[model samples]
Target: MYGWADSTAIEVLCHTEQCVVCGDLADGFHYGVRSCRGCNAFFRRAVTFGMQFSCRRGGRCPVDKNARCACRACRLAKCFAVGMDKKAVQPKREGTNGNGIQSQDNSFDQNDSELENRRTSPYFDSVQLTSPESTYSINHSIYAQLTDYTPLRSPSPPPECPFLLRLCYEFSEVKRRRKCMLCKSLEEILTEDCSIRDPATAEDFTVVFQTQMILMFEWVEKLPEFKMIHDPLDKTKLLRAFALRYMLLDNVYHTYELGYNDRLVFVNNNYIIPGQPSSNFNSCEVVNEMEICALMFGAPMQTLVSELVSIIHGRNITIGEIMTVRRLMLWNPGSIGLSSNAQAIASQASNNAMKELQQYLEQEGIEQSEQRLEFLLLYIPALTKHTKTMYEIVRLIPSFGKMSEWNSFMDDVLRGV
Candidate 1:
């Protein structure tokens, strides 16, 4: 009887120590509340940014770890009601630009020196491509030049077959030349001084994911094919669907590079091992919101990525391979509400690219070249599965969902779903 009573007391003590906001194990007192880092960060950002939120459910929404993300308004309200001090939040430090004046803008600028450094770096020029067949060389060059050619502002009619092929080629080149971070080898990434560790808090994840999404939008805008989609609605829908799949593919590629056979991969090459506390929680016995989210979503995703890695294991995926797959993904024919003409154009482009890719692989003497071609085709379904999971997770987060209202690109993507 005494043993039972002691156990009950311990259980209550543990429960009391849990974060009041998300019910995750608390990481000690933060901003005057016993909360996990995710909640603590969330509250801090809400206060610091003067972020406004509206509840989809009229403010009565449950604010547990599982449902806390459902309503930002309620979540923030609960934070205040639970004694999280708004005044405890500190101002973000201002960063200086090249001239050393404090810059007010916190948003990442493409023209920043960091990006310029990468563009001029000798490492980017080190990748040596063997001279392709004359046909491939001519097509590749044409596509590469398309980055400099601006699309017509007026909505033009669908391009001709030859033009479609050129557009596909151009897309492949643009993606290749952009030096996608995902395309970098694990060794290269690890050696680079800019590698950011995995985000520990919900706010950090939100910022990193949102930044990646923005970069993806910029990448899409550079595609001649995307600009050809005249209808604003169609463009939005296509971009949204494409963005989701793009993010998934990027993550899968990164996971492959890292050789994370069974671990969960996040943006910026950070990963989480299964059944273990993530790097952020090493100091406390607490389980963070991200760790919980990963556990719930990571297993199936890891399995899917592992299967993909196994298929292409030991072989270095070439620039042509990556380009062809990217081109095929961009022109998704099955996206909801895609027009027949667009579908036809996309299908033709993908088929043409596939033929070109097959020829290149065969010329390179890859064993089972035909099988390797088919493997690229297999990425579509796997990417779709991962994208759907991500979309569901994003929808649950009110802040991300709210993005649709403020960000046109995000709106198009979310609304297209």
Candidate 2:
């Protein structure tokens, strides 16, 4: 429903002198794809300004060198469609050259330098949407005033940052809407009031896994930070890390919340029982748990569900904190295997999210805020221990045996993570 009929297709590189996003003059590679300075500037300004453009003519605008300005939304969409990475558009540095890149890849060097000088100065962390008829300029005093913090905060804190507020809500909504995704399915009647008495069937696990994976992508793609990561491999790697943690954390928390003992609940309300034979966890057929997991563990894999649920239930974790953990787990900029641009963008995004969490806590005036922060952030690594076990179990599933053989979007995710 957007600009070109095939919005997801990555346009092939045309002649060296042609731009991939629009058939304009080429200006080398920008964000891993070849493009022109004109398109580069437009993309940069759009991202840097956080511009949200809409297509009035149903979004199927023709964006070419001759009419790049015809539809801002389509042009921007085409940029991403042709691989113009938003992560490549670095955060607007208050002062030039303060931002750091985590990876040694120099592909970002030129773009970073150029973007540094062109970005809006962070006169104040908050930006206002001015009337389209008027111009907005940086107010140095506002920046100084905003930074002047005291040990004591105002009795009434300001409004929650819009992005953070929206993020918190979106995270919360996922839990509520996860059910009914596949309306009228066999597991549709499963609910919180009951425990999954039988071991989960192979097909039960696969259907839930597929649904989770789909939801994961949906959630990840909406993130502004993840949007910036233009490299497909880097995106996959970051998602891979988030996926295991997401699957494990989301289910464990849901299980604990519903007071379900030692049984993990799926998004669609199907629950996986504890102490089932590993053979019962099959993805190859509708059979109950496959034996491949047992061969790896040399045991029933009882610890998988029981131990996971224990961590959440014992802690009495809250949904607010789980929401934070979900976003924070996207990518650790320091994690190995990320490209330079990906690492830099991830670092900024994760750091911003961390800061936003603190701000949110303070704004809400939550009790023992510092401790609340510590418990969840630290729990990230502790929760990671189960991922190794998870990867071992899921990777052994016959359907997932060869990643390249699968046609689903999860192919890259399963391999990269």
lDDT scores in order: 0.51, 0.55
Task: Please provide, for model 2 over 291-404, each residue's C-alpha lDDT reduced to its tens digit, 9 standing for 90 to 100.
Answer: 444533333345656556655566656555676788778766235578778878887887887787777777777778888888777677766777776666565554544332
Which residue pairs in candidate 1 collide?
A: 240-413
* Tens digits of per-residue lDDT for model 1, 141-204: 2212222231212133355534333444554333232222222221221233434355333333
Instruction: Please report the TM-score between candidate 2 and the true structure.
Output: 0.53
Per lDDT, the best of the predicted structures is 2
- The backbone clash count of each candidate, in order, is 1, 11
On TM-score, the candidate that comes out on top is 2
Using all chains and alpha carbons, the TM-scores for the candidates as numbered come to: 0.48, 0.53
